[model samples]
Target: MMYQLGKRIESIVLPVEMLQQLKPSDFPNQWEYEAWQRRNLKILEAGLLLHPLLPLDKTDTAAQQLRQIIRGALEKPLETGKNNKTMQALRSIALSLACRTFDGSVSETSHWADGFPLNLRIYQMLLEACFDVNDETSVIEEVDEVLELVKKTWVVLGMNQMLHDLCFLWILFNRYVVTGQVESDLLFAANNLLMEVEKDAKAMTDPDYSKIISSTLGTILGWAEKRLLAYHNYFHSDNTETMECVVSMAVLSAKIMVEDISHEYHRTRKEIDLARERVDNYIRSSLRVAFVQASFQYFSIMSLHRMSSTR
Candidate 1:
């Protein structure tokens, strides 16, 4: 397949020529082939149309034209044969978008797959490869080897160590969540990694990196806050082991967002106590909720007793 195409060849992907020659029989079944074909097209849609590396011009018909072509393909899959007119047009516009840059210069470097969330999503998928295939909840022993392969993709994805740390943080957090949140070690690992991200957040200045880190940290913080904001509601004696890591992460992510990403917090942040404030809020809110629930249950029981006496 494309001569084992050397990795990170200036963002080059499966060429239009190779795509044109593909057929359904080449795969194990029609469904698999169609899925593969649809996926390739969607990748093009994501990279070129949805999230190209550069700011897309609204006046550029190439984007609109590509959108229409993809939409039509969705309704009716297009032929990929060499002589197909649709394939030729798809190749042209897709390349045009992939090759365009901010400075209006012609360059061989394609930015197709190097966009913001798209690159992050691709990196996350690659990160998932670290998990054991047989035991989806567990990590493979060869994670270092898999990570080495992942780091090589950084060249293609326009990623650096900082972004890698952030993605790895969320990946671990998510795996912990999806695996029933019993694995406190994953939470611990994510919190430790987040310490590195906090340092990176302080020093890194790239806008793209900022945008991604903000969203990624926001997501991690959002999930953390839900549990921490009412720890009594969620955590119990049976599952209190993960609470420390959760609270630490929640507070750290909040501090990072406030100190690094938020303009409003610049002057007042140093005076504000993130940990103490968060813990106080959680305790007060949870106690108020519990008190209200208890009152409601007591009143309901009294009303039921009165109804029994009247009967």
Candidate 2:
């Protein structure tokens, strides 16, 4: 009886579109709803069942571990203000999260090919199909190719929450960034991709994706100001002081470009230049200290890796 009940639970948790087809009225009894919930609970508990060798708990831990790896990767250039530290950190976090969710393991060596690549390809295909870009015959052929790829990949990887989020990010990036390209078809395709992602986002109940998307959008918007002033303000209060200093310097450079030398271009140019230069000098001094801290972090990781190998 328990086995039969469990089987019934497993059968009902289909795609939302499929679930919508069957009404509670069709179930006729409370037992059916209870069985549905039980199956969902079981599926949720299993967590990336394709990689059974890696237990869900391990996968969860791996996600947390990858965050540390990303921090290490970004810390160096960030400290020296050689790159956009906060933006680099955000990308690292996104990539780390995707790796954990898709690969079902955390290691120094992991890439989108592990699982995310295939998932993203299918997502892009689906977005294209919705627009009927090709002729009727070509559309059918393309969809078949996409479906076959999805089938083979899923057989190897199984579905996971991380793949879903990666797809969302790909769609978002394609829509907002890639769409700015000069190509008309590409821009249209990007619009279609974002619409699909927005639909998927609405379906998800998790708060993490929401938080990351909101923060990422804010970061991108701040990047558009031509000066890094907005970026500095956003990351200043966070532990990313190195990134803040870099952005402050960038903002100072931008101020210099707009003011001081361009007296005929603007009235406040000289005043802004003097103030910005002072701030820039202060940040540069602080950055030297940050570089030392970043160097220590890098060496410590290398030392730990060496010790582990010896054991």
Candidate 3:
């Protein structure tokens, strides 16, 4: 229906109407219908009320009314028959909220479920389609096709190329980590995406974008640094490939975060020095940890040997 309507939904009505138009007979039982109904209603509440693109007006009676309807329906399924009065009231108020615009007039695109973290979560889930479900570590060969199809929803998702890159970077890095870090390719690909994010960070000055980027890169940097600073433990000669990727990612994330996050940031010929200094710190820290571990092992063996001699 959205495509039939030229994809100009611009409101929560799209999902809400679809729910309302369903007949109870469409489900296996009344209980099933009610459960499905409640779940969707929570989605609407999450998308429309909890994390709306526009800051909700606490004084808006219509918003309150919408909440009441959701809250009530969560407890008891609301009648959603085509002629139901409750559905009529919900449709009216939800449409009103969704039609709001920055210039004080409505647009053909609405942002009900497209708020910051929510949008990121949804987009990341979509990007997960690129990974094979049967083997979670393996990216599907059809990833390019899946991504192209996923990009079609960017308008409704309020995603731009920069946001997509950032989200995809996180997905790659996280999937790599979660899958026992065996897919060096995923880590390698994530470092590549981090470079794109670095470019975007340098180009964009929008605070909203910066905030999200900063938070995300901070996480990536912290995780990357943890491993890099303990490379003696985290990486072996066999996995030097992983070490290379982690170092590159850590340096890039720190560079981007430092440059974009600091208002007083000044650029110098320090780019080369940044990597040098970071790698130096990682080496020193890792050597210290390695030394401590070796000493502890040496003392433990010595104690065991002394006990055997005495025995």
Cα deviation of 2, candidate 1, in Å: 5.3
lDDT per residue, candidate 1, 1-311, as tens digits?
Answer: 43565434664654443466578888999888777777888888887778888878898898999999989987777798767899889887777888887789866776778898899999999999998888767888989998998998776687889989999998999999889887677888899999999999989878877787788888888888787766777888877768877888888888888888776775674577887898888788778877888899999999999999999
Q: How does model 3 fare in lDDT? A: 0.83
Worst 10 residues of 1 by lDDT: 6-15
Kindly indicate the candidate among 2 and 3 with the higher TM-score: 3
Better of 2 and 3 by lDDT: 3
| Model 3 alpha-carbon miss at residue 261, Å | 2.6
Predicted candidate 3: what Cα RMSD to the true structure? 2.1
The true-versus-predicted C-alpha distance at residue 218 of model 3, in Å, is: 1.7
lDDT of each residue in 208-269, candidate 2, tens digit only: 44444344434432443322333333345643543443344344333333332233555554
Each candidate: RMSD: 3.5, 24.2, 2.1
| TM-score against truth, every candidate | 0.81, 0.25, 0.92
**Lowest lDDT 10-residue stretch of candidate 3:** 4-13
lDDT of 3 by residue, 49-146 (tens): 88888888789898899999999888988887668899888878788877777677875666766876677888899999999989989999999999
Which residue runs of candidate 2 sit more than 4 Å off their true CA positions? 1-144, 158-180, 211-311
Model 3 pairs in collision: none
